[model samples]
Target: MAYRKDNLRTVKQAYTEKRARALGIARARLAELHRTIPELCEIDSALAETGMKLVNAITAGAEGITERVAAIRAENEELQEARAATLRFYGYSADYTDVHYECEDCKDTGYVGTAMCACMKRALSLLSLESAGLAPLARTQRFDTFSLDYYQGDDRLTMQANLEIAKRYAASFTPASESLLFLGKTGLGKTHLSTSIAVEVIDKGYDVVYASAPTLFLSLEAQKFGRDSDIHIEEAEDADLLILDDLGTENPSPLHVNFLYRLVNTRMVSGKATIINTNLTVRELRERYTDRVASRLLGEYLVLGFVGKDVRMQKIGT
Candidate 1:
């Protein structure tokens, strides 16, 4: 048996449970009606007999097989009408016997023919977000929770405008959209707004990876050195929305520097969506990383500057 990733496995398991529950409910309803309503049972039995007769007529080299099948079909239709009337009399809908699937397009199978259903895709997206370790933070740091009241004067107005732009960006995010750079000091809400955008993108059913710079670059370094060989993940490259949080916090090493350059260049060239949160200015970034990576990031990304007091500190004091 082929192994499935945790997210896909979770989606499959959920769909399986839903399918079983829906089918079980349907079967119980059918049994209840069959026992309580004798007319339904009789009509169903007669319909089954007619179906068998039609099949037999088709199998045998019998003449007027079409007429036999047509007559049987007409009788079956009348029986169906009687069945519907009986259910209605019992204060049940005509489709009470039918399984009420979670997703009508897939009938709870998680697929429409060979294609995956929209509901299944969303389930997988949520599972993927959980697996990315962003689910908990996403719940608390949504755009609705981000407030401009934390800032003052020019900073407050700028933050309000930035909030609108961030909302628009999240609302219409695509892999093809311009990359974003969240630039601000430590006390600012760079991480908050970045994470807010990430939550929205993930809910839109796109793959997203939100990681601190040290964690991200360290994962890359480990992958290079065979230390992280237990599971394969090239998250920054593959994610539809790659949110690299606190870019300046990572310890500098040859491995980290080279990988950062590659990650930035790869995302820029591939037109993949990326958001970088950093306390470092463009000048600082140019001095730290090579000018190529800095130029690409500055030239391509829509820069959003954040300014505010440390809300964490304020909340703590309260």
Candidate 2:
């Protein structure tokens, strides 16, 4: 499996510590065994000697030495039984060698039979979450904190419809899911709905990349200007789900505009899921960006219009 430097460092450090702990446990167990029954080790040495004798006898002459070899083999078997009994007295299984590995196949490398190891994939996924800055998002917004009570009864039907759509969209998200475009005025729960979806998908173990348009675009611009465009593309292209919050908030340069188009197009063509929460209306989006951009979005995106009074304004008693 191909791993980035950071991922590799994390995995290698974790695996090394795990292996060390296992070895330490194995050593302590063996030390207890040797203290409790010192004769077992002696028997093991004699058994090894007898094994060599059997091999040497088989190589020399297979005729008269058969009886001697048989007697030695019988004695070795008896010693093995005695050793096993000693180990049983110490409460260790016969197969408890000095290697307490979690997986004997790849020894917890999480790979076997030419495929990514399940454990390794889980590690990579966790590292991806750390890389994507999801921890802060989870702490800031929570679904349980969402109050449908804030929705307006004047547009009760529209508000209920939007809530149900958000619920269903979050509930039914898959890797092959179509993109989403959340359109409405500011503070109408657009950010809340998208962040809620991000939480759900993240809980299901997908790597969700959640960042505002300004934050993401600034980072992309920095990478491009600093000669690190490849890093920008890799992150944008490879995330399982991309949540671009407040799309019209960023200062649009020609480089950023083209970058945004190519980023969205590349992800769409590759069938990766994207969720864009924008306060801009359709007409505004077309004017601010381009018709081609708006057209592609309208064509492929599952648009959900957030409906309600501005919750922020209500909180401020405006």
Candidate 3:
């Protein structure tokens, strides 16, 4: 359950900016208060020195040290009371000088002690989704939002079973979880289900990478040729889960075929799960990608054949 290094760095930088912004605003407010009320300036200065005074009293180890510490505490409390009274006299809130953080649980630091805070986790999940290219679809293609109303009869029953399998797989996914191969025609919910799985796995804190087959192959080709590529093949191989959508849509080329085999084989060897969504059947897959790639897809991956009318078309018609 980890995020990519770059994504983590992005989130950490955001937290840094947030914390600095809060502190900066608080400092500016305090400066304004000090300028408007001379009495507040003195009170704040005295309050700041109280900490040093206590440190000195403890380190000095002189006689009557307890009495000195007690006196310091009493004086600090009195200063606070005076400060509050003075602020009220000036028609300002007593806490007007406090820094307001976005997430109080970790004070916008993105962590609580040595552990990552919930806010940070959520931030990482969202960033990961965006980086994985699933953010837009994830917003609407989650498991709960999938509709079986577009299916009917045997097709509906088969889709229902497929939906349950996808849900279970996502709920129990791990780095070493079995891979999946979604076979169906265009707009039959293959993309929707695969995206749903990716979203669920991402929300559970695992890094996921989602890319269409054509885009993935193009990026890989660019990288292979020393051109600028947004997505690295290494990221796809290293992700906890990879959702490769619209397979068999890429232009047929020996380079792409070899790259596909290598990518799938590498992830398989590394025990990472991958979900491949293709409109091609097992026979068509073999014909398109050759036996080497198709063998892995059939032998290693759990095949789910979707049966339904084009749900996207149904939606548009209705």
Candidate 4:
């Protein structure tokens, strides 16, 4: 799985800090033990010298090398025993001075040789989820957690199909994947499925950006007015998959309409995937977003219409 550059940097920094902290703690413990037990210090010093002796013996010559290495190993084993006994005699654990890593498999390095450790993958997934604005829904709104019980008859079949399509799209997502348009009323599982896709895509190591229509437009406006930086807009344009939720809910404005056109057109030209969730019907969308924006969306997007009662109300028996 590939992670975004920034996310990778963040994980690497965390690993560096973890490794340093573990080593630091171990050093502190060793210093404390040295101060308390001078005999332990002598034993550790002798054990440390064995490493150099072994290296020197190997480089010296092949003749008598095996015997020299054997002798060194015997001495090292004796010193290690002495050190452990000294620690135990002082009521300390034998491994008290050892660096205790959070993940011993990788020694908290976040990697095993050239491959990434599971710990690092999990860290990247969580960071991506948070950065994509899907952390809140990630726990309960995954594809597997989506319940077809809320839907009935044809609605259930349609939703099941949609779910399968979403899973397939996420499984094979790339920068050039097809854009999606989720047309449905509120609380019809559009947002949930979109969130599910985001979670899966992010887990697959693709950069995803999720933003509500109102929030996205407001951020764009802020950037235009010099009140905010343009990073948000850049991310929206450059993400491997961008999900704009709750379209047509933002306050109507000509400037926002123009921004919408630019955003859609830019991502389309770049071949970046985008998912737009809206309560507006096709006719209403055309009326609201003008032909320019609607044309690109209609011509290019794979539109999925969601149909079902509000799952939230069903759960509350309302």
Order the candidates by TM-score, highest first: 4, 3, 1, 2
Q: List the residue pairs that clash in candidate 4.
A: none
Per-residue alpha-carbon lDDT of candidate 3 for residues 1-318, written as tens digits (9 for 90 to 100): 577888899999999999999999999999999999999999999999999999999998889899999999999999999999999999988988999999999999999999999999999989999999988999999888899999999999999999999999999999899999999999999999999898889888898999899999889889988998767788898999998999998766988889899989999999999999999888888998999999989999999999889988999999
Which parts of model 3 have CA positions greater than 4 angstroms off?
45-82, 88-91
Model 2, global lDDT:
0.76
Give all candidate RMSDs, comma-separated: 5.9, 7.0, 3.0, 2.2
How does model 2 score by TM-score?
0.63
Global CA lDDT of candidate 3, please? 0.92
lDDT (Cα, 0-100) at 1 in candidate 1: 11
Error of 4 at 305 (Å): 1.3
Candidate 2 residue spans exceeding 4 A from truth: 1-16, 22-126, 154-157, 227-231, 312-318
Writing each residue's lDDT as its tens digit, candidate 4 over 1-318 gives: 457789999999999999999999999999998998999989988888999999999999999989999999999998898888999999999999999999998999999998889888889999998888888988898888888989999999999899899999988988799999999888899999999999988888889889989889888888888887424988888888889999998666888898889989899898889999999988888889888888889899999989989888898895
Please say which candidate is ahead in TM-score: 1 or 2: 1
What is the total number of backbone clashes in candidate 2?
1
In candidate 4, how many Å is residue 30 off?
A: 0.8
Specify the poorest-scoring 10-residue window by lDDT in model 4: 222-231
**Most accurate candidate by TM-score:** 4
Model 1 is weakest, by summed lDDT over 10 consecutive residues, at: 1-10
User: How do the residues 149-195 of candidate 1 rate in per-residue lDDT, one tens digit apiece?
Assistant: 78889988999999999999999988877889988888678877887
